[model samples]
Target: MTSGSLHRLTAFTTTANGGNPAGVWIGETLPAPEIMQRIAAEVGFSETAFVAPAIGLERTVRYYSSEAEVSFCGHATIATGVVLGESVGDGLYRLTTTVGTVPVAVRKRDGNYEASLTSVEPKHTAAPEALVTEALTALGWRREELDGAIPPARAYAGAWHLVLAVAEAQRLANLNYDFEALKTLMLRDGLTTLQLVWRESATVFHSRNPFPVGGVVEDPATGAAAAALGGYLRAEKLITTPTTILIRQGEAMGRPSRINVDIPSSGGIVVTGQAVWI
Candidate 1:
């Protein structure tokens, strides 16, 4: 591996500096986990995806944040898929992540090689009242600011996330929170990020993710959370079955990302987006 050739890419958004940037290291062997975490910290992104070839086209991948290793990351996977598609060729690439084997399809569409990844099995559970209260306090938000339509829940696709729907768009726009308090709560509850969202319509939504535990204040685009959200909506019967939902994230952070989530009648949620090389 060349020291000057650490390849990196941004995923879930087509434009440069417009998505969640993830560092991608494609090597013959995996880097040491600690070293990976150090490099990820140096890169300063929410998560970095490392890929080591398992068998031919199949790859063994792992995600590392600045502080620790994550089970799965959507934006990183999408970025890795785009990198592979351009470096190798556009086709179906299998990434065996720590959570499970995830299949990502990459194709040259509209002159850009976009990638779509199907998440592992997703599930949701009711968030305990005390936990939600603590999170709200850490976020400096009142309980009345929450949307009554969608109750708080802890959702998991590959990683655990606390989903909270804000009542107004203004509440989502003004995002500032205590780092230490949130970090403690997230670590204690096994939360990767707080998926705060506002629904514009049945199929359109805007989201913000607070990821202090990952050593980032916020994540621009979160694919795992999107998948979990699809599962949650399906489980709660909030949206119609067999629906396509569009999620707009990272706008508040100035790195806008567009994610298309498809909820099927029965299986893992599918998240589609375009990634670009950095």
Candidate 2:
């Protein structure tokens, strides 16, 4: 963090302003937790990923919000990959996170660098009844407003998120909620974001993320959540295995982002998208 120089990148979009933006900080070693949080607050993105690669097999990578530390971040990982590709040359870069070692593959795609990360083994669990009730209460929605197609589940790829599927797209758009209440509940439950989604079809889905826990009201494009959704859908047999699905996000906020998810049999889900400088 010397010289106060911070590098920024827009992940999940080939062109600038098309995907969620993230700040990437590459330093000799990770800054103090408080210092990283301060830098992230100044960077003012949904999430900032800091990478401090260790020698040999592990690379320590940490994610931070404007207010605190996060388990993992998808866009920031992609952004960090691109930055690593540019500086270290394109190849596989291993990021040792608080959870595990995350491998990111960076390559030149159509003249612009693209980074795709393989998440730590994903895990999903049933959403708690009390948390669901509190979330529904905060969102001003009732039980009937939810979609039966995708039941409530707390899914995790590299992070934990509660998935709530609404039956209609409009429900996903009108996102006014009690920020403090949701944040309190999320903090208590160790939630990263609430994956609010609408299933348009078997292959196409639209989503919104309520991220009060991150000190942000909403997340425009959420790669980690998308990966979690892919795993949840496959685990529940909601979608067939070896399926490629499209997740359209950020449209409600006007920064439309598209994430291509590939669910393979017996492996971590692969989420691919392009990013540009913003």
Candidate 3:
């Protein structure tokens, strides 16, 4: 596979320069693991998606960060959906990922394409106290800086994430962390990202993700993290009703992104966003 065969897109935002940039490769067959890894590293994006275009509505997809393969990736899935929509047709595509089967819906809106992905079954568990302590230490944040209401959790939809809610939005914005330390912690605990967030309102949140494990200091927009957060809230009973919430991420990095998460009483969490060509 060559770089020319890849499609560069930014997900979760319509702006040409905003959102998480991902490399989407659509071909007759998936690339070899080594080739995909090399392509991802060369693309230099947080994540690159390798997809075998669907026969009918089912497509085989794989997600790789610059350094390793991820079981699932939301932004890359959305970007692929838009690509498929433009190349195939606007509708639904069932993506078979390493983790599980995910269904992505695509449509054209306002001259740009939008995609919504339904994650696999969502679940969460209490984060290990030791892990939380070590993570806070790496982040240089005091225990009191965390939001008591939301608490800390190891949330999982397609991938595992440590969800930490900050008491104030400003604390979430000041993101200076020991990258090596955090990366070590995340690798040991098998966490994809540290979802540091502040609840702006009952249904609105501001977030920043530290993704050193992916060889990136920060992910401008993280779809898996948003799905995990929605699952975390629903599991913890923080969300009492079936509603839609807004997650505003990447703003602190100057690459603003918007993710819409719809939580139901049960089942998969729906994460929606728009991707555009960069």
Candidate 4:
């Protein structure tokens, strides 16, 4: 229950300057829920992860944002995986999250540690017309700017997200929105973040995640959202299965991050990124 138990790290970084910062707390037993919330708020990251021992290579994990506890968080999970790899050996570790059980593999590649987590079963549903209109209004976006090929959807892969695809990259780059308005809408609809994206190519995409629910303006690297996006694409038959796609995020925020997603024919999506000790 002390600050000394907390470890600060950055995930999905290509360099030290890039990536999303997260606090990882590894303890023999988790602290009380209120204590965890206080620690996460003090850390003030988009999300903080708490880890405790389970069976053999399994661990019980919890995620909390500055505002509240999250069902799942990808960047924080990656940060925790790297920390575990350093303490224990590099291998596969099972994480029991609030949403479901996720399996993360940690390994050292080219003298750097990397982690990949397989998401829970992902599902996507058409967003309600009224909700979409409200979200666009809050974001200061017009309906015409949307990409017709990719419709707006409510996607879930451990966490919920509103997936909005814009027609142009510049549209995605200009991310100025009413924080309070968007936060209110997200909270009402149980959305964790707004997955605003622009497609650069068939296999490449650029994304920005607005995480007002987490008490943060944006998330630099959002693994859970990325997994939901992958599932959405697959379920909609927008992409061929058994393919790998790359997502570039946080460029506008000046902390560039890279996320690699491997989509299989069935089952969970695989999200990969690197973490560094801060």
Candidate 5:
């Protein structure tokens, strides 16, 4: 109900200077929607997670950005998992979200808490040329900079993201977009963030996520977008199954973050990362 009850943590950080900061509030009973929204806005993070007790190893969780409530959020979930692991011991926790059920496993690795969340079934749809063109125009990107191998797509795991792969990492780094223009288009298309990426190697990628919908200029670490990307790669047959890939995000913003994605042949994608108490 108050900011004092919230736990501040940074997710997907490999160092103290990196990661996305989130506010985690766990209670025996969840608060009302308006209250949650108010708390999230006051917290002023990209997203804040509210968790309440459900059945054994299960919890009812809700995600709220400063502006509105989201279907799901990856970084907040990871942060919640680590907090629960520390208080309730390491194990798998089932989360009931607005979209669907997600399973998160928490464990201690090398004296640090690590959490992995398996997202709901991921799916992708081809993006219309007009939509892509509008987004590129808002982003100040040219069509020639896009990667032909990876076409534009609307991908979803827990939340929807527009996947745009660029040919060079520099293109991804030069991220200056019309905030109002992009936000209008994204809201019309029901997009949570734009997953702009560049492939550095077969298993490595550089990414930037613009989250104007969440009232943020950019997200240093985006777990939901990473899961959607994994689903897109698998559906497009761009990567081998049962493989692990590394994502480097937020570097251009000065807050470096890392996300490890494990893609299985069939089923939901697993996104793993570490969170630290801030």
Candidate 6:
């Protein structure tokens, strides 16, 4: 029989009602992949993190959505870090994900735990005109509505994401798209999520992510995408180096999540957020 203790927590929001919820399963040893998949489906959250060797500072972590296994999940990692901190005291925890090793620093702030996870080396590639057109068609977005300043690109921190920046906030608010069409396009393009965003200011942004591939309509908070955005901006020279950006997500969906991204001159991007018990 499978064995693990499951904890439910929401990431990027302090309140119990906000943020993206995830299931954290801690066990001395990981169960079979099939069993983990079943547990993820049963959890019914956007993602569930399976952490093995529950008693150590360094552990192996795997992420699974309701549909399939994901290479990496930012919010789930944040939740896992807090869970580990509560159980093993506050410190740095190392997680070995399928993509690479991620170091997460955990600390108690305002009587609640917060985690900062440094992603694997981030990179980006230009999105071809044809690919951008197809993605826009799937999302029912017109090419003119896009921000010409921020060209479409495939950005990756741990998982690949299509970073599309719209020119207006209203366009992002009315997010209506064909779920199946977007899912098919994402699968074909090998995208984990579409980072649909609107630049509110020089260092502030608002975003919405369509995650049909993960069997979810939309993600309230997407940390991996946030980190990818930071890397994309730095790599593409869209913003000044060694700056921090704040991403406000889930507001359109009523969850109101906040993700803080710290970008250095080089190396991995750091994604920081808070998680609360659900």
Best by lDDT: 6
| TM-score of predicted structure 4 | 0.98
C-alpha TM-scores of all predictions: 0.96, 0.95, 0.97, 0.98, 0.97, 0.99
- Local distance difference test values of all predictions, in order: 0.90, 0.86, 0.91, 0.93, 0.93, 0.94
lDDT of 4: 0.93
Error (Å) of candidate 5 at residue 174 is: 0.7
Clashes of 5: 0
Which residue ranges in model 6 land beyond 4 Å of their true spot?
none
Put down candidate 6 lDDT per residue, 94-166, tens digits, no spaces: 9999999999999999998899999999999999888898889989999999999999999999999999999
Can you rank all candidates by TM-score, best first?
6, 4, 5, 3, 1, 2
lDDT of 5: 0.93
lDDT per residue for candidate 1 within 102-152, as digits (tens), equals: 999988899888888998999999999999999999999999999999999
List model 5 lDDT by residue over 66-151, tens digit each.
99999999999999998888888799999999999999999999998899999999999999999999999999999999999999
- lDDT by residue (63-163, candidate 2, tens digit) is 99998899989888888888777777678888888888788888988888887788878889989899999999999988888999899999999999999
Query: Which of the numbered candidates is closest to the native, going by highest TM-score?
Result: 6
Worst 10 residues of 5 by lDDT: 1-10
The sequence of per-residue lDDT tens digits that candidate 3 reaches over residues 1-278 is: 53325899999998878999999987778878999999899999999999885345798999999999988898999899888888777888899998899999998888778899999998888998999999999999999999999999999989999999999888988989999999999999999998899998999999999999999999989999999999889887898759899999999899999999999989999999988888
Residue 259 lDDT in candidate 1: 93
Query: What ranges in model 3 sit over 4 Å off?
Result: 1-4
